[model samples]
Target: MGTWDIGPFDNDTAADFSYRVDEAPDGERADVLLAAFREVTGTGDEYLDADLAMEAIASAALLAAQCPGGEPVTTSYGPKKPLGVLPGELRPPAVAALDRILAADSELLELWEESGADEWKAGVLRLREVLTGA
Candidate 1:
């Protein structure tokens, strides 16, 4: 996927958060970025539109980078809300696109060293757990 500019969504706050996430390195910085995205996007609610879905998927891909093999993290709890409700046929390709984005970005994983953002990191990890199925 090409670089996404923040369009008119939630008074442009979504764009700001997305940009931050895009710029963040791995570890705590990335975790904070993801948390900010979730907070600004209000992703916890149901009925995610396409733009929000893409944002959530991108965040998920970033979180997946921290996990080994980039596979979904298995967890004991289920997802609270649908991350992005894509059509059945489109879901696979969308996920593939996000994975490609993650793969192409080397700096994301390279900066995964500890940064003392434990709370934010745990928040992103919890979202990952929900996304992947715990």
Candidate 2:
């Protein structure tokens, strides 16, 4: 496969971002954790080297540590309720699991940017759902 440019953040056009964010205006850093986790999980193309995956995970952790808000991504679940504020039958157990994860990590809080970390966090949950075959 060829290389892919993830592109750096530019405030003038940040509104067009598809997903992810960093606490500061420097868009170059946002979503490192997500990328790292993706690497850990070995996202996409089976040929991705295991060592690269490990390195990516390491890099992600470092970036997350440097996070301006000191959080990876905000959990959507509320204290006493499940996430997905829709009028339908919610997955009680899934909601509970997500809630637990959120509660355990106060540092996972996220900043509000247009389609910011919330979207990234959702992607994370989606990955878990798929992996667990939920």
Best by TM-score: 1
lDDT of 2 by residue, 1-134 (tens): 12121111211122122223323234333333344345434333234342333233223323332333323322221011111121111223223333333332222222212225465455434433432342
- TM-score to true structure, per model: 0.30, 0.22
- Model 2 segments beyond 4 Å from truth? 1-100, 111-115
lDDT agreement with native, every candidate: 0.37, 0.30
Question: What tens-digit string does per-residue lDDT give for candidate 1 at 1-134?
Answer: 12222211222333444555435554344454344345324533333344444354445544443444454423212122223322223323333333332332322222222333344334434444433441
- Output the lDDT of residue 67, model 1: 44
lDDT, candidate 1, equals 0.37
Question: Which pairs of residues have clashing backbones in candidate 1?
Answer: 75-133, 75-134, 76-134, 77-134
TM-score of 2: 0.22
Clashes of 1: 4
